[model samples]
Target: MPLHPACECHTATRSYEFSESHAIRGSTIGMVLSKQAIPDISQNGGKHADFPGAKAPYVSKMKFLNEQSYDPIPIYRVIDNKGQVIDRTEEPRIDNETLLNMYKTMVQLNQMDEILIESQQQGRISMYLTNYGEEGIQVGSGAALLPRDMIFAQYRELGVLLYRGMTVTEIVNQCYGNHEDRDKGRQIPMHFGNKEKNIVTASSPLATQMPQAVGAAYAFKRAPNNERCVICYFGDGAASEGDAHAAFNFAATLQCPVILFCRNNGYAVWTPTNQQYRGDGIAARGLALGLHTIRVDGTDALAVYRAVERAREIAIQNKPVLIESMSYRVGLHSTADFSNNAFRSVEEIQKWAQEENPVEKLRLYLEGKGLWNSDIEKQFAKEARDIVLRTIQEADQKKKAHWKEMLKDVYYVMPQHLQKQMNQMEKHLEKYKEHYPLDQFQSE
Candidate 1:
């Protein structure tokens, strides 16, 4: 009867778990069905019965918030652009004087960049790199470092060096490639290396310092010093390199005490950030790799300082921390790209120069606080200019290095063929001594 009861299944059956968690709160039954079953969830399938009039207008709809909700990562800040603290949880911890100092370091770094770049243009120096929009990142983080801690800087970190009390003369000497340079004039301009300051010498290769930084941090951990850690600085463009990923993995594996600061300035040379990756920000990538990470407004010195302070604490606890300072590179990547008419528009540059420039914001903060008046500002500018000019003049007055520099430093003794080459160079210098008169140069 009824086509044999054992063989018959008359009804269509659909099976799924019907827990309260499976029910979406704000969606209608039909809408939920349309979304769950359909490849393309749309009202075109006669689903927009709620308002038939909505069909004619063709308002494209986004999916209802079931699983995908936009949760913004918390942004940490200590001081506003006006140099006032808005957060009361750590009210007495951060004071105005500390902020002023941070502001001053930012100014000094910006000023130094301006001077060095201009010096390069004037043919007074061979080369220089500027941290045009990134002074706050380096100086603020550097302020959190202990005196004995190691700093592995990218070439454009004179601000951090200055904060550590690197004298103007030392900077000039390094730039000038003189005997007074701690590297013995081995490296080029902005390739800073000072044992006294505990800053590693910068190299020309991108992301080359990443591993070295990790090694330094590992050493610190093994040695187990309370005051020892390694703070490494690099750009967002550098993060795309393999060395960066390797360094992160190595540091995470070892729990090395390293603070990796990435100034995500939207460009690596000429490439923009949109082309870099589809994922979230660089700080998120750091977090994904099991590092304590933070992203902060790089233009805000106080926020950067506080984040760095926290990062320092984490680092001391044998955690590798990554900090991505969101900033804009307002100037050309270097002095070599002088054309304002190329790649980027002048209007874009001017907009940032007026509003987003770190130096401009710091000046505004200083003025707002009544900490710096017009007269003092003018005096500061004049003094900075004079100091830069004198430093350049002194560096230029230093004697040029001899060809023996090429043969030295890397070996305890020269090989026979190398010695022959050195002899040839010495002969060439002797023959040209009249033209480059040794007596005309200052004593090393």
Candidate 2:
């Protein structure tokens, strides 16, 4: 049966048939079965074995399936690189307001990345990561989700937080680790979490959110008339982790309603996709794991929105889906790493940034629709920059979280040992107050 309209399962099936023919050609048992067969077992209403573990047809010949047995999964795309819709039928029926908001959010996200990355370079922030070329995947998927939907994001999905109503000030505060920050200056820059926004705090470890998101989905499944689903976002690099495989198996076996969204942005730090895995992209792994799978062109905003919208529909029906969004990381992995030094070329990054940029693609679409122009673009660009700069200024001026905040949140009640430690630190600070930057931190 056909799956999504953009899916090319037929091609996969045809490739598998061709490979199987070659695989069984030299086997004598296969040759004998071709010429002779036992009495039909279908007369008893069962042609395949009904084993406790699997229900599969019994083959007369031995065969092994490999990666080459199927064609690479086709990427689902609604628009071309020029931002023209490839299929009108496939275009999502998003309203002008929603479409405009998505475009604006992507633009804002791009602007934020530019400013924040520069801020890190200027020593304003300790570290940062940019969404860069993958803005469409973030905003498009964010637009498709409900406000109530829980999001488990890897560190790079700042656009999703912005779309989900996290304020610019809130983001800047987190980056600055100011007194107003929700995490009490505990996390690194870009590790955003808002309980009210339903986005879990991002951790530095790869793929840890996968199993946790599945556990949340299982809880939602057991709830009475559960209407919400969990969306777990990770990178292609994270998919290689054992936790990722565990999450996939448990989600498939327990039938959790979760969307395992993988951003295959060509590299995990300095390692490229070719070195990451030998098989087809991450979508192939999803297929083997028995999840509803789709590969999407992450640069096309419309395509991402349509793919995620459908994925959400399937997910809320108690089916887990995996979407591998393919794009390029036009920026460095983070402020800590430098690209174009060894692994990839600057020209290659420039090519993708110019021709396949998600922000520019959506801008072209909006321009074609008469919803955007050079004037609007300039105005919005200035406004976005002003807002980010203003937020950063305000956040930087704010006092840092109190020195004692580091020890306060670890326990519901301060233990005796912790209290003694806190007292010792307080006494040490009081004795050496002139040596430390006490004015920068909040007072006791």
lDDT for position 58 in model 1: 34
Model 1 off-target regions past 4 Å? Answer: 1-74, 82-84, 90-97, 338-341, 366-370, 431-444
Clashes of 1: 0
How far in Å is the alpha carbon of 252 misplaced in model 1?
A: 0.8
All candidates: TM-score: 0.79, 0.89
Per-residue lDDT for 304 in model 2? 87
Candidate 1 lDDT, 1-444, residue by residue in tens: 111111122222223334444546865343223223322213333333223223232337865642135444456665565555577574325467765676667766667788888888988777777787777677777777778889898877888888888888898888877666666667888888778889888998889999889998998899876667889999888898899999999999899999998888878877788888655668877876889988888877667778888888889889999998888777778777756448678887777666666666666666776777778777777777778778878877777565467577667877788889888867987788777666634443
Whole-model lDDT, model 1: 0.74
Clashing pairs in 1: none
> Best lDDT goes to which candidate?
2
| lDDT of candidate 2 at residue 29, scale 0 to 100 | 31
Runs with alpha carbons beyond 4 Å of true place in candidate 2: 1-47
